[model samples]
Structure formats: structure tokens, C-alpha cells
Target: MECNKHNQPLSLYCPSHLMPSCDVCISTSHSKCNGITSLASVVEKTKIENSKESVEKDINYFLSILDQLVTSKSKNIKTGENHCIGVKKSINEIRKEINKHLDHLEEKLCQETDIIWNQEKSKATDFISEIEGKRENLKEMKEHLQTVTTNTSKLQSFLGVHKIEQQVHQCQRYIEDLENDERTKEVDIKMKQNDEIENIIGKLVSIESVGEVSVVKTEINLNKETSLRRKAQVKSQEQSNINNMTMNIETKIKINIDKTIRDMICLIDGRFIVVDWHGKVNLLSSDGKLQKQLPIPGDAYSVTQINEDTIAITYPKERAIKIFNMENETVMKVIKLGKLCNGLSFSNNSLAVGLRKEEIRIIDLEGNTLKSIQVQSESYLYNLVYCDKRVIFSDSRGKAVYCVDDSGKQIWQYKQDLMGPEGLCIDTYGNIIVVDFNSQRIMVISKDGQDSKVLISKEEGLVFPQCICFNHNESSGFICDYYGTYLAKFNLSFG
Candidate 1:
């Protein structure tokens, strides 16, 4: 291979610079460089002799780990299915209660209305009969008067006329008495219209939705006992030889800021960026001393290192991701997106964005959309980490952790006793560390999905843990105690 800089064949290796040098390049530039060695010698020393055997052993080890994870996840899937059946049964029970109550109301209302209609009909029928009787009496009096006037002599007619007149007067008096009675004046029953009652009936027994129902593989343990329990179980199966191993924690810096801390990211230069609930990003030294604070245009929820001197932050409210250049301490560029940016992770020269509705949009550094990934979840995806060509995301509403491939296929999910998983990070050991806000604990899970453990808890004074990050070497880590108004630092003692 020719050296791109010198345009000549590589001839020697320089240990000081850790790169291959050409003859002309070494003579002119690397002549004073220390630890110069031949390229053949360096290659022979670093190359493995039994590469085939080593590959087989590595393959078997990884395959065994994969088998264990598959078994565990299969059990979780069964549990999730059972939980779904239980939820459906519960919903049916509630529906039965609602139907029973409404049916009773309908029966009672029908009976009451029937009684009212019968009473009103009886009053109407009685009024009609009384009017008919009066008409028949009047007809009889008119016929008798006509017979007396036509068939009798003058004197006889005079006597009969008086009697007929008396009869007519009587009939007239009866008719006037009927008119004077209030009950005779158009007796009828009617129901008055009531809009309020109609409105109430329409609103009663209506279906109201609470939230979405989705089946997810939830955690086996819900509190800070996950790690301890798993560790005890593993330790019980074997004997330990190492001694004097202890994990120690300390209060690194307690900055009493009134603002709520959303997330914190550790930089390679021993500085940390603390994002708050508001639009402020605070830069602090590794010792927790305040250095400078930058104000973003919108609420900043996530911060991640893009390169050695540049960091990317998620501005969900503005639907944009801004690149913050650390050297200038200013926003260098803004990648405007059609969807809102929530969780963010930069890897393989691409940015995996956790958008709304549990979707991850993969975009290049230039803000062009490469692909969109929809996670197998109904809840929103929160903080995420990109490591080893995979995206590890936390679902705050679902209370689970999900890992997905580049093509948006879910590999496996881990959930147990997790309340609200927010920010996640991959440690040097390839273990996933999650900060759960609702449970106020930090959980660590192996990348293979076989084991999980709790690193810190509320008992350790971690109140409302938001974000967790490891330093460059992963020997030490930092936790943002959001509501506690402090930062917790812990040292890892690997046994």
C-alpha cells in the first residue's frame, strides 16, 4: 500500500506515531521519531498465529450468549401475552358493569312513561263522554218542542210551550254549568320539553378512552433489587476468589440550581453539559464547578458528543437538532427536521433521532433523512444510545428498553420492575446503563440481554435520577440527581 501523503510504498512502522511511513516520508519527517521499526516485524508481532481456532472459540462463546438471551426473551413474550389476556378480561368486566347499569335505567324510564300515558288517556276519555251526553240531551229537548207546536190546539199549545220553555231553560243552565267548570275546558295531558334532561341522557354511558393498550416485555423486578438479586443468584452458583472489592460513591458537586436538570453528558475533556427543563445548558468542570451556561432557542432535552470538540443536542420544542461546537462554545449548525427531535445518538457518521410516536429517524450529518425506524411500541421513545452498530432506546411510557438494528428490526427488549426509563448509555464493557425517573434508580443490563442489575437507588440519595454518563475510560461515572439538586459520582470496582 502506498502512503497517501508521500505517494510512495510504505516501508517502515513508527511506534511513536503508531502509523506506517514511506521511505521518503520517514527520511524527511520521521527521522527524529522514536521507536522506529520495520513494517514486517510489526505485522508479525501483532498478527495472531492461530486465527482460525480463535475465531471458532469466539463464535461459540457469542452463540451461547445469544441462546441464553433468546430463552429469556421468549419467556418474557409469554408473560406479555398473559398480561394482555388479563387486560382484555378486565375491560370486558368493566363493560359488563356499564351495560348492567344502563339497562336498569332504561327499564325504569319505560315503566314510568307508560304510567304517565295511561293516566292522561283516562282523563281525555272521561271528558269526551261528558260532552256527548250533553249533546244528546239538547237534541231530545228540540224534538219535544217541535211536536208540541205542530200537533196541539192554541190553548194546549200554550201550556206545552211553557213546559218546553222550562225544559229548554234547564238544558241551557246545565250547559252553562258545564262551561263554567275548569275541568271541561280542553282537558289533556302533555309532557314539557326539557333540553337539559336530553343532554344528560346523551352523555350518560358514553365510552371514554383513557390510554392506549400495548403488550410489552416488562421487567421482572421493579425496584433497586434487580442488580443485587441477579448478583446474588449468580454468586450462589460459584465461589469468588477476588477479595477487597467494593463500590464507593460520593457527592461530586452539589450545584443548588433552581432549574430542573433534564440530562447530562460527559465530554472527553473532563467537562459536563447539564441541560435543564428550561432552555439553558450549563457547562461544568469534572469537579462540578460552574463554568459557562448557554441558552438554546427551545427546550433542550438531550445532549451527546458528536466528535472530540462538537456535541449535538436535541431541541424537541423546536423540531430541530443543533450542533454545539465546544471550541467556540456556540451553536455551529441547526439541522431542521420535519419531525420533532427527542432522543439523539450519533454513530457511524449518522444521527439516530428518537422522534414522536416511538419512531427513530436516521439522518446523515447534513440533516438529510436516510431512513425512518418505527419501534415496536406505542409509547414515545426517549433518550437513546448508538453503540456497536445498534440503537438502544428507552421508552419512558412503556417502562422498557429496546434495541434495534439499522433496518429498524427489534432484536430484543428488556423490562422488569422498571418504572420510567429515560436516558441510556453503553459502558466500556458493552453494558447498558439506564436512568429511571419514576423509580429513581439506575439499572445496568448486559448488551446480550441475559442479566440486569441496579447500580444506585433512592436509598443512596438519588432522587429523581434523570441522565447517567460514564467518563472516557468508564472507570468512573456521573449521575444527574435531577430533583436532589446535585450530582452523584461513583467508581466502578470490577471483580
Candidate 2:
């Protein structure tokens, strides 16, 4: 083989190398062979190496993808299996719950059906029993009707016989004859008895005892004696009753006078005020000594002690009210009302004045009217007393006493057979005491609006009680009589 200057083989070298070469050269040439066969061999070896590496790389990538796919498929299968199991379990649980609910519903339905069946059975039994009872009653009625029909047929058959009719007529004629004989005998016996009675009466009239009794008039005398004795007894009883009533009245009067002299009349700070119906305002001492006599400008309807030294007076005729200061002996304020004034009271920093037209006017101390309350009434307002947020008054026309709130709404009212209610007072327990003018009686009514009890019916010792006042602390009251010239007192007690 020939080698080139670069020591390549002739076949591996370029076409320009055409020379002989040594073994080393041949070896070097073969080592550095540039022939097509050598190049083809190198390319085939590199392709095999690259193809093996590529196959190895592709195998690794495919194995990795297969591993991922297997892992994902296993996970998905497990998830699907678990989901199926869960679905089966959930389905089983739902079926069990449905079975339980269905069982409960079936039990409830069975119980309700049983109840309805039992009720219907009972109703059917009752209806059957009722039908049986009605059938029995109908059978009994049929039997009774058959018996009644048989009796009626027998009566009809008996009534149809002519012999029986003739016998009945004969019997009736015999009865009439016997009745006539009895009547004749009765008349004859009556005549004989009358004759016997007349004879006995004649004998009795002729006897000395009968004639002596007639002559003496014993029965008339006995009756006269009995009547006289009865009259005497009655007279004695009436006299005894009169004495007892008189003593009671006297004792009550004395007790009342003593009580009124003690409790109702009080000396407030050495200034004495006499509560009376007179027009004059008498300022007296504790010993009943008149100190100053101040004549009112008009008719003094009411007198109230405002304080230790102040006194209020209502003059209805003048339609005015005046406050008198005893210490200064001067008038503090004078208020002229537009309506007729009747009664006055001081409470809760205000003056409550009663009017004749069934109204109450609340005024301050300075003579300013704050509120006016119209009392519902069919009569004139006679008197009023304010206590416990209630205004109690008497109505002359209605013959009753009424209590109203501060707003003029009626709280209670008591009707009586009084001729006219003139004065009214409330006790400590809110009992109403009324003075009747025409009936001449002291009527006491309970606070709960009951009937009026007659405390003093007639003025046997008293002329006429005009006004009344109560001492709440003592449970006592006083009444001023118009003609008695003294105040009567009473101590009240519960029955």
C-alpha cells in the first residue's frame, strides 16, 4: 500500500497519494485512514453509539412516563374503589335510615288506624245497641196496642147489648128513686133535729144559769177585761220602750257633746276658731270665751284653719273668699270667684273650693285658680271635704253623697232615702258621714259605697243637724245642729 505525506493509506488517503509505505507507515496510515470505508465505519460506530444512548434515554423517559401513568392510574383506581365503597356505605346507611323512618311511620299509622278502628267499632256497637233497644220498645208498643184494642173491642161488644142497656136504665131509675128517698129522709131528720135544738134552746133560755149569764153579760165583760189588760200591757211596753229610747238618746247626746267639746274644737296656738253656720267669725279662747267677733262680708259657708295664725272663709253670697290673719287682724287675700262657692279645704299646697254648680276649683294661696273640675251631678253641690286625694261632697237634689278624684271623675257614690244631703265628712278610715237636712238624720255610709245606716234618725233632743266634721286621729266626729245651739258628737265602731 502507498501512503501519503501525512501517512494515510492509499485507499483512505486522497487520490494524490500513490506511493509505497513501510509497516509503521501503513499502520499510521491505517490509523489515520481517510478512505470511504473508514469514514463509513466511523459513522456507523457513532450512529450505533448515539442510537444506543438515544434508546437508553428513550427507555428511561418511557419508563418514567409509564411509572407516572401507573402511579396515577393506581391512585385513581384506589380513589374510584373508595368512592364506590363510600357510595355503597352511604346507600346502605340511607336505606337503613329510611327503613327506620318507615318503621316509625308505619307504627304510628298502625296505632292511629287501630284507634280509629276501635272508635268506629265502639260507635257501631252503640248504634246496634240503640237499634236493639228501639226494636224492643216498638215490640212492647205493639203488644200494648193489641191489649188496648182487645179491651176496646170488649167494651164495644158490652155496650152493643140491648139487655145491658135496659139494665143500666133500670139501675139509674132505682138510683134516682133511692136519692129521692134519701133527700126526703134528710129533710125530715133535719126538721126533727131543728125541733130538738129549738126545744133545748128554749129549755136553756128558761134555765136560771143561762138567764143569769145573759143578764150579767159575762162574755162581754170577759172580753172587755181581756182587752183592757192587753191595752195596759201594751201601754206599759210602749212606755218602757220610750224610756229606754230616751235614755239612749240622752246618753248619746251627752257623750257626743262631751266628745265634740274635747276633740273637734281645738285651740291652735292660743287662737280659737268656732266652726259654726253663722255669718260672724268668732275668735274665742280655750275656755269658750269670745275674743274677737269679726262679721263676714257675706254668708260664711266654710271655715278652715290654714295655719297657726291663718284662717280661710268662703262667702258664697258675695262669691268671694277671704284669708284672715289672726296675729295681724288683717285680711291677707280676697278671691272673687265667678261661680257660687259652697265649701273650702286646704290640702297639698292648694285650696279646694266647692261650687254650687257641681264643680271644684283648685286655687293657689295667691287667689289664682289653677284647675277647675266639673263634678257630674244632677243636683247642687252642698258640701265638700278633701281627704286622701279624694273630694267628697253631698248632693241635695240627688239625695246622695259622692266622692271624686282630683280630675273630677267619679270614684264612688252612695244613694240614700235622705230628703236632702247637706253636709258630708270622711273619717280616718274614709267612712262617709252625711247630715240629712230634711230627713233630720245622721247617715253613715261605708267607704266602699254601701247603703246609709241611720246613726241618728230623728232629732228627739236635737233640732236640726246642719254640718259635720270628723277628727281623724280620735275616730270621732261632731255635728252642728242649726236649732240645737250645741254640737253633737259620736264615737264610731265597726259592726
Candidate 3:
């Protein structure tokens, strides 16, 4: 019962940390925490009849869930094994008809089948092992639960119940993650043999195997409980607004290529079409690695995804937009704009271009003008995004962000604590996330453009962050530094 550090007998419980702390601990580390009292007082205040029963009930509930997950994942392993066996049988049947010529082909197909099946099997085994580990954690706490309850000591029961309850919540989040994960679903092994291969094999001397083998992943929702749970979670967030949302940095990639990234767009397929102010247009992988670089050799300012197979990049110096086929990285057509384009955004088959003047041009992919929105600011550079029938643009010279309608009217403006604003984006919940060049931070402004919070700052290692974009699914986002060699990928989560 002595203090761990100051050697003062542990006399107080910190409900925030779910622990018993000495006086010295509370004065410093636990200063901001509330509800500090003697451990015995916690049980008295909460009016608990049986903390043991309450916590044990939660443990049992989670253990049942873990048991279900173990059974389901094991079944997927069995299903994949049976599927692979069936595929191998077909390969052998072809071998019987084609004789020894098909022997090598059959062996190769079976080996390929084993490889694919084993990969899935390993995934299931690993998942089951992890679930079992969680199960063991609950079981250990259950054993300790008896020790705490045996003496009828309020201090022991209070602390035990608190720790075990925290474990229950951890287990709940883990189960929720399993429900969202694709690996929890059934993994189907598909190896189709070409009938022509068996028929023409005897006629021809040699050929390239029977058919291609692949692991076909199904999109079926594995857990209905999870599906409904996710819907409820999303609905709960929808009840509020993005003002209640926040972000956590998930991944960081140091761009190996030396290019100044001005703006970037995340596509539906997790790829990025990024533009460099230094005359380079590159296709980047989800991790910010350079995949392919277009040979435009012009000072590109911004890029946007126009369609699944097309992208448009604006070269301010050239005063033109290049519509290129993303498949081949070749220019399909050129849409010449007489004004300098600083940023581009596409929605509803229309393009919104930010020019050097106080106008925002709405154009189509075929270079037809749709609508031009007029604003009060005549800034030289404007970076903008179009979403929900509103054009959210950043005026670099004004050091502010503005929301406008298509009919040349202003909606709202955000102009506080902003320093050298550049690229901005509207998140799924209509919150505007913008990166600042001079402030070296990122901010999340409310949809009404009234309230804003600094989501990240230079204290968080941001060095002139210029562009910020969220993925289509809203699960992840990326921030590009103005220097172009560093990108921060963040996980987007909402209450």
C-alpha cells in the first residue's frame, strides 16, 4: 500500500486513469484529472452491489463474441481448402485426357492453387490466434476477479472492476475492427481451366498452362452485426456535424523523388494524381511512392481527377489545362484557358477552375464554360474545391478561405490565424480541411466557415504543408508539404 514514488501510502483513486495514485502523483501527472478520492469512496459513490458480477458479465459477453469469430474464421479456412481440392481435381481430369503432356501443367496448377489457398489460410490462422489472445486476456482478468471479490475489500473490487471494464471496451473496439476488415469474409479460391487448353493440348505441341489462377475476394458483408453497427456509428455522427470530428496521423512517407508538390487528388482506387509546381505530373501510389511521371515538362500548378480514366493538370505558366488519359499517361486534349489556373476540382461531370482574377470558372471536360462565380477578392492565386453545390476556394494573397455559390455570390469566408493559404478540400461531412504554407499547419474549418481549429501545426512536424486531401471512403487522408519530398497520411475518425 506504500506509494510507488513518494512512498506515501496510496490514498486516492483517479477515475480518469482508472488507477489508484499517491498524493505526489496527483499533484503533478494527474493534476487535470477529476473525481480523485479514496478507493473505498469510489465503491460507495457508485453504489455497486456486485462489481464482480457487472464486470464478469462483460467479459463473458466478449468471450462469446470471440468464440463466434474463431469459429467463423476457421470455417473460412476449411472452405478454402475444399475449394482448392476441387480445383486440383479438375486439373487432374485434364491431365488424364491429355496424358503426360498435361502432367507438368497439372502440377503447376496444383502448386499455384496451394499457394493461393495457403495465403488465405494463413490469414485466417493469424486472425484466430489474435482472437484467442484477446480471449486469454479476459480469462486472466476473470481469475483475478475472484481474488478481488473473495475478501469483500471495496478498494480491491473498485480497482479490479475499473481495469476489467477498460479491458472490455478494448475488446469491443477490436471486434468492431474485425467486422470492418475484409479478411473476416470468406476467401474463395478460383482456378479455372480452359476447355480449349485440354482440347487443343493434344493437337498442339505446347501451350502456356491451362488457365490463369487467382484469389477472388468477395465483397460480401461477413458480419451483419457489424454492418448494422457501422450504420449506427455513421448515423450517430450524422446526427452532429464535422465540428465534432478530429484526425490522427496514420502514416508518413518521405517522397524519394525531388519534386515540389503543389496540389494532389486522391482517386477512388487509392491512387493519386499529384501536380508539381516545378513542371512534373506524377502518378503516385497510395503510400506516396512515385509510380509514373508524365513528361509534360511545364510548370504545373494543380491536378484533379476528372473521371475514372482521365485527369486534368493546369500549367499556370502555360495558361492551359491538359486533359490526359491516365491509363497511358498521354495527353488526350488540351483545354486552353487564357487565365492562370491555380487549382482544379471536378464534380457532376463539370470542372471548377480557379483563375488569377476574382472569378471561378466552371467548365466541362470538353472545354465548355458552365458557370463563373464572382467573388470580392481579386487575389492573384486562388486554390479551390467544389462540393455540395458550393465552391470553397482559398485566396493566397488574402490569406483566407471563401465559400461561394455558382451564381456569382459569396456564401461565407474564413479569415483568421491563416498564413499563406494554398490547397483546401471539403471532407465527407462538409468540413473544410486546408493547409497553410506560412503557418506550417493545417486547419479544419466548420462548414459555415465560422469556427475553425488547427488540426496540425509545426509542433507536430509539419514543414510548410501545402495540400490536404481525404480519401473517398473518408477512412484516410494525405497532406503534402510544399517541399514535395514529404507526405503525411492521416486516419480520419468521428465520434
Best of the candidates, TM-score: 1
How accurate locally is residue 12 in candidate 2, as Cα lDDT from 0 to 100? 33
lDDT of 1: 0.75
What global local distance difference test value does model 3 have? 0.77
Predictions in order: lDDT:
0.75, 0.60, 0.77
Better of 1 and 3 by lDDT: 3
lDDT string for model 3 (388-458, tens) is 77898887667888888888777788899988788888777788888888888888888877788877778
Q: What's the residue-level lDDT of 80 in candidate 2?
A: 76
Q: Residues 276-300, candidate 2, lDDT per residue (tens digit)?
A: 4335566654333556666446556
Clashing pairs in 1: 218-415, 219-415, 219-416, 220-416, 221-417, 222-417, 227-453, 227-454
Q: What would the TM-scores of all predictions be?
A: 0.52, 0.44, 0.50
Q: How large is the C-alpha RMSD of every model relative to the true structure?
A: 18.3, 52.9, 40.9
Give candidate 3's error at residue 365 in angstroms.
1.7
